[model samples]
Target: MNLYAIFAIYFLMWVISAFIMLPFGIRTPDETGEVLLKGQADSAPSNFRPGLVMLRATILATILFGLYYANYVQGWVTLDMLPGYSAAQ
Candidate 1:
């Protein structure tokens, strides 16, 4: 793949990873028995950590991107393997 395509794929992976990681380590004030702020929503996480989430997302994205690149190089899967896909269309 070209450099730009690689970057784009990596960025897409990172975004998906970040979103997937967002809810894993979260804890609401009620869940942790902490006092909620005056204006804080009940569902808002009291112990949200962006740095940790970003770190986890980066690691996961890197691994996923590596696998994706390997698949691209190895041709482990192709469009024909997917149902309803036809190149003749």
Candidate 2:
């Protein structure tokens, strides 16, 4: 695909990866036995590491996007391969 298409796809993949990675390696304030701030929720993470999360997300997204790109290039799967798909028009 073109550069713009690749970038768009990668951006989408990154966002998805970020969400999937959010819950991992997290410790809620209650779990860590830490005193919460006045407005902080009990469920808030004691050590919310945005940098680490982003790093993990980037790695995961890279791998996922690589696989997606490979599939796109190799045509390993296609719309016609779906169980109920009909190409007739």
Candidate 3:
């Protein structure tokens, strides 16, 4: 894929993950032997965290895209480009 396309895809992915996905519920045990659930599961150490999810997705996408593009020279997974105004005219 082209650089811009890859960037835009990652940007969109991040936005979706940050705004669309709901927060996960946290489950933990308190000192009193009771389930002490705090904020979302993304309480910094929670396994399933939503905080900075966009950052994570963007980073993952960028890395994968870079790897794939670097290894593939045939543009197998390249981004598709549409005709411009000049071509239409």
- Best lDDT among the predictions, by candidate number: 1
Which residue pairs overlap in candidate 3's backbone? none
- Candidate 1 residue 70 Cα shift, in angstroms, is 0.8
lDDT of 2 by residue, 1-61 (tens): 8999999999999999999999999999788888889998888888889999999999999
1-89, model 1: which lDDT tens digit per residue? 89999999999999999999999979898889999878889999988899999999999999999999999999998888889997778
lDDT of 3: 0.53
Against the true structure, candidate 2 reaches a TM-score of 0.92
Pick by TM-score: 2 or 3, better one: 2
Shift of residue 81 alpha carbon in model 2, Å: 0.4
lDDT (CA) per prediction: 0.95, 0.94, 0.53
List the pairs of residues colliding in candidate 2. none
Give one digit per residue, the lDDT tens place, for model 3 in 1-89. Answer: 57797678667655665554335343334322454365534333334465556556566666765666565766554334443424334
